[model samples]
Target chain A: MIRLQNVSKIYKPNTGALSNVSLHIKAGEFVSIVGQSGSGKTTFAKLLFAEERPTKGEVIIGDWDISRIRQSEIPILRRQIGIVFQDYKLLPRKTVEENVAFALEVAGAGPSRIKKIVPQVLKIVGLSDKLGRYPRQLSGGEQQRVSIARSLVHTPKILVADEPTGNLDTIHSMEIIELLKRINEYGTTVVLVSHDRDIVNALKKRVITLHDGEIASDIERGKYMI
Target chain B: MSFFLSALRIIRFAFQNFFRNFWLSVITMSVFVLTLITVNALIFINVLGSATVQSVQEKVEVSIYFEPDTSDDIVKSAQGYLLGLSQVRNVTFVSAEDALVAFKEHHQNDAVILDSLEEIDGNPFGSALVISAWSPDDFTFILEAIETPEYQRYIKKKDFTDYEAVISKIQNLSDRIRIGGLVLAGFFILIAILIIFNTIRVATYVHRDEIGIMKLVGANDWFVRGPFLLEAIMYSAASTAIMVGIVFLSMRWLEPWVSTYFGGIDFSAQQFFLDNALLIFGSQFLVLSVLGLFTTMFAIRRYLRV
Candidate 1:
């Protein structure tokens, strides 16, 4: 579960990335944060992981006051939360399996455990056959799948996919959305941040729309609405 | 993970970084070898130059020529007095007749000089004492000691042997070589730092995306910085090893040439390096590794925030 109360973020010189925002999501919920380019959606997601702290309010994740988290504690929080970027940030020199194993390695997982879990997660992402391939050798969809597999290696409580399908074709996009749905069915809280109308409309899930740094609407089984 | 496991992983990742950027490794190591070469060359020159200067100073001696009528006993007594001083290495007394014979031998190639020497004078040369000292610095004292009133009246001409200019020139040249070598070595040290810095920076840039991903995946700060520091040490170590090989090989190869060219005054560079191998190599390794670590630390500070 994640909660943000009266969160306001100011860059500098009167530039507000997010202002007066309060939101909450229950455990095991698949929530989509919908916004335009500068609607504070990315900033809101960053706050969940303490990548950027709130300038003026509380950010609580499962009773942890992440708003005042120390620098040393950030890595632990990150291990508990899986974040996927638009570019699918994989180590270029690492093979697909090595890339997936890296997450467990950072988490101090032993070699035998890493060897065991890596293939299982890669199987979940349906890329077990391409474990030996580099990132450059894989397609955009496969690369994104590797990123998803890495995020799942830690079995994080929350998975935030910021534009997971932004660079994919329609078929791959739907595939990624289905993967998110499958991940949600396994009880991990999912925060999907995107503005792709078709994907948001098709999901018909809980959607929170942001306009000018404030939440414009929040609906149960919401549609994509400006 | 256990501390041992963590150390193992760090070393593994360092090797990965080292081999992944193999060319960068070679460049870094090559640059390091160059810097060491500069330092070793300076050492060799210092050894050779000291020997050459000492040999030149030994060849320089002042000759005190007494009056033509000065007795052999007196000249030999003066020689004995000169030899008694600890500063004096040796003193040889030449009689007037013997001096004339040596004069004829010196001009033996010139018939006119030889004929003139036979016809004009019975013995134009005086008894002279040739005095050598333990060091060129002792020349002043030895010459002044012989200028006492007991020996001054009998002294006809004192060839002061003005080799100060030569010795000063040699000293100035040696100082200049050392100073210049240091300056050059300093320049190379700077280059080595920059190259190592740039090597780390480039490695950071190459892994910039991986760094972000590692942070996102929850890597601790030291976990991210450890391999980099290790890689720097590896570069320093490998380069130092290669430099040691080059130094050992070159000195061994040139030992004969060194003996041939600088034949006297008792100096051997190869022996010096061999005797102080640990001190020389250990200090070099320590300095280079510390330099590398500092550069790596500085270069990684900007990237560790992720």
Candidate 2:
């Protein structure tokens, strides 16, 4: 369950990245935020992670008021919500398994828990056979999968994929989207931000379009609409 | 996890990361070893020099020349008086006849000096009273001992005029040794910090992706910064151990040389070892560990802040 009511984010004095935007999605929903560049799509996701707070109004994820979250509590909030980016921010020096284990390590997961869960997450993303490979050794698609696996280590209640497939070829992009679909099916709420019209049209999921820092459309089982 | 467990995990990760960049780590540590060794050598030389000076000062006996016609009985009374003073370790009487004989023996190699001395009719050398003090600080008290009325009348024109100035110069040299030791230690510390900072910066650059990944994975500030701090600390600690070893070995090797050149000094290498080696090592460990900790922490803070 996620809710944003009249959320406004002004970065500096006059740079209103997001202005008076209100949106909500139910638990287990897979929602895509579609927009052109500078249309507040990334800002919306950043707010969800408490990376940036809404300058006005409330952001409620499940039961927490993230807008008022303290700095020390940000990690807990992040653990509850997984974020994946187009950059595939996998630690290049670490193998796929180490990168996933690193996430668990930071979350203070026990070695036994890490040993048990890292393999399962990697397996889920079909990276089990490539666990020993570094990020550079893997293809772009596989590196993103490792990122996805790392995100799943916490079994976060919400998985936010911000342009997750932006750097992939069409086939790789579809594989990534399908992976997200599988994760959503496992009952994790998913928020996808993208400008890929083909992928958006193919998903046929709930879509919210942003134009000039305002929501232009919200459609159930929406198509890609400009 | 428990605190120990967390620390152990950090250490493990740090070591793993270190080996991953094994060549770089070795290069960094070698730099540390080289710099620390130089610093240690400077401190060693500085300490050894002062100790030598202190020993020399201890033996710097004050010579009191008697009047040309002073009798041996009066000189004997003067020796007795000087021997009673607490500052005087011992007093040796050099009679005029004995002084002339000793001078002749010392100059026997020089025909011109021997021939000139023989040309004088009577023994021209004055009877000398030599007073050895316990230390340089005791020289002032020893001077007062010789100025007694019985000996004062026997004082000749050749009484040591520059005794106080020379003693003070020796004392000043001792003080400089102490101050120089501190400055040298501090200078090496600054250099060590700069070396570690640059080393960690290189490491951070190599692992920039790891840092970014940690940040994205919901790792907090400590999680992101811990490994770099640990790595820097590891190098510092290792370098400290090596430096201590080098210092000890050098001291051992140089001890014989020092004893050979200036064994009569009280604060010889052996005496200094008996006095301050453990204390020096303990304090060096403490100071170096603290310096290493702060330097690594600072480097990590500046470069690895998420």
The top-ranked prediction according to TM-score is 1
Please give the C-alpha DockQ score of model 2.
0.56
Instruction: Enumerate clash totals for all models, in the order shown.
Output: 0, 0
The DockQ-based CAPRI class assigned to model 2 is medium
For residues A163-192, could you state the per-residue lDDT of candidate 2 as single tens digits?
999999999999999999999999999999
Please, what are the lDDT tens digits per residue for candidate 1 over residues B1-306?
466777788788889878977887787778778877877787777667766777777787878899988888888889998999999998988888888888888888999998887797588888999988887678788888887888888999877656767656766776776787678768766776676567656656666666766787888888888887898788778887898889889988998888787676576677888898889888888888887788777767766676
Model 1 bad stretches (over 4 Å): B30-55, B65-104, B116-135, B148-157, B178-195, B245-281
Q: Candidate 1 on A1-226: residue-level lDDT in tens?
A: 8998999999877889998899889999999999899999899888887888988999999989899889899999998998887889898878899888878877788999998999999999999899999999999999999999999988888999998998999999998899989999999999999989999989888999999999999998998898
- For each candidate in turn, the TM-score is 0.87, 0.84
Q: What DockQ does each listed candidate score? A: 0.67, 0.56
DockQ category of candidate 1: medium
lDDT of each: 0.84, 0.81
TM-score, model 2 to reference: 0.84
**Residue ranges of candidate 2 with Cα displaced over 4 Å:** B1-4, B27-31, B66-77, B83-86, B95-100, B109-127, B134-141, B153-158, B162-209, B248-285, B295-306
Question: For chain B alone, what TM-score does every candidate structure achieve against the true structure?
Answer: 0.78, 0.71
